[model samples]
Target: MAINFRKGIDSSLDGVTKLVFGAAWDRKAAKQSGFARKLALKSGGKINLGGGQKDIDLDLALILYRDGEPKRIVIGHNMDPVHGAAVHSGDNQTGEGDGDDETITLNLTSLPAWVTEWAVAVFAYKLGTNFDQAQNVSLNVYDASNQGSAVLLDELMPTLGAGATASIIASGKINRDATGNPIDGWTTTLVDKAGRLGSQGDDTAVLAFAKQNAGI
Candidate 1:
């Protein structure tokens, strides 16, 4: 399999079957400044709401494929578990933490034999929101097969033009080998793209994105 080394993160998945995909970001820098001031206020100072800055929320999702067809979507908090916890999602509504705000875990070994690919992505869920509204936004994959020694496999911090309206970022995918053995010989490829893939209030957004990514 030819890997897109230049646009993708190349790593040895020789013995890795459990992977953790994480996405994180902070409130826009301008918004954070006001929040910072609120924290630094005197004892009786009134709390500031950052001048009514809009809250930024991002969601992590996995679109699973079976026999080259988009089959299921494992969306954060909304669609929690797929295949009886084979894939788990950790969703954070408020990007208040220091680390990953949203996460999706994939147990490749538990996936069905027909499953072929899993597309990774993150999107700004707020109406009319885009990547330009957040700060330090990143999507990453980690090899978590080890008990407590997970290592970062790869990561990408997506950005946009001054006023681009794209909300979703297709980070990449894990392609099962022709042998159909999810436990081994799977390749992780990065195909970073930022654009609109689905409509607001649509439940099939992730699946639509998945099909488009798979060229189906």
Candidate 2:
């Protein structure tokens, strides 16, 4: 609906950071069960193992809902600046199960009731200089249901260099069927480049739905 930015007061990070563009939700909902579970399958299917030029990685998550049901979906992956490979870490599928637990958590009870659905995404960029690279990323949100898992913005692809930032934009409002299940009505786009990239260019398409709905 509306977006606003303010100075960050929390000590989480030094220097001024943007705050509360609107009603913000945690990375997760109940911490027990929610949209996090729906993303496990997708997460497992998108890991990239092939080696290539080093680049920044971007992680993303989306929250969508209808009639007070919250759903969470996550997009984690790496980008090779030189080789131009957009590798996706895949969907977390389910909440932290065993092994490498890489899911973001958030509290939802504190949010306003009108906030029916929300989404969060995290990025783990520039894992390491060589093998055994680690992804550094986190993003999540709260809502009523986790029905937005079917929609994917785009396939992860390489950008340009380490200096450039990987950006993704999703636009469109959540549409539901007679049963309130999430239907497709939005479009998503992913973009890579050098220097700070805004919601523009070929990348602008990534956020088509986000721009129309959440205005992210």
For 5-91, candidate 2 gives per-residue lDDT tens digits of 111211111111111111111222223233444454457835433333333223343333334343323234322211211122344
Cα deviation of 207, candidate 1, in Å: 1.6
Residue 96, candidate 2: C-alpha displacement in angstroms: 18
Tell me the tens digit of each residue's lDDT in model 1 across 1-216. 122323445434557768787888787655447555757484344655354444576677777777667777777655654665445455676677687887777776776767666677776554676667677778777778879866886666665555433333443334556776544366665556566646643547657755665332
lDDT of 2 at 158: 29
Off by over 4 Å in 2: 1-60, 63-122, 125-162, 172-215
Cα error of candidate 2 at position 187, Å: 5.2
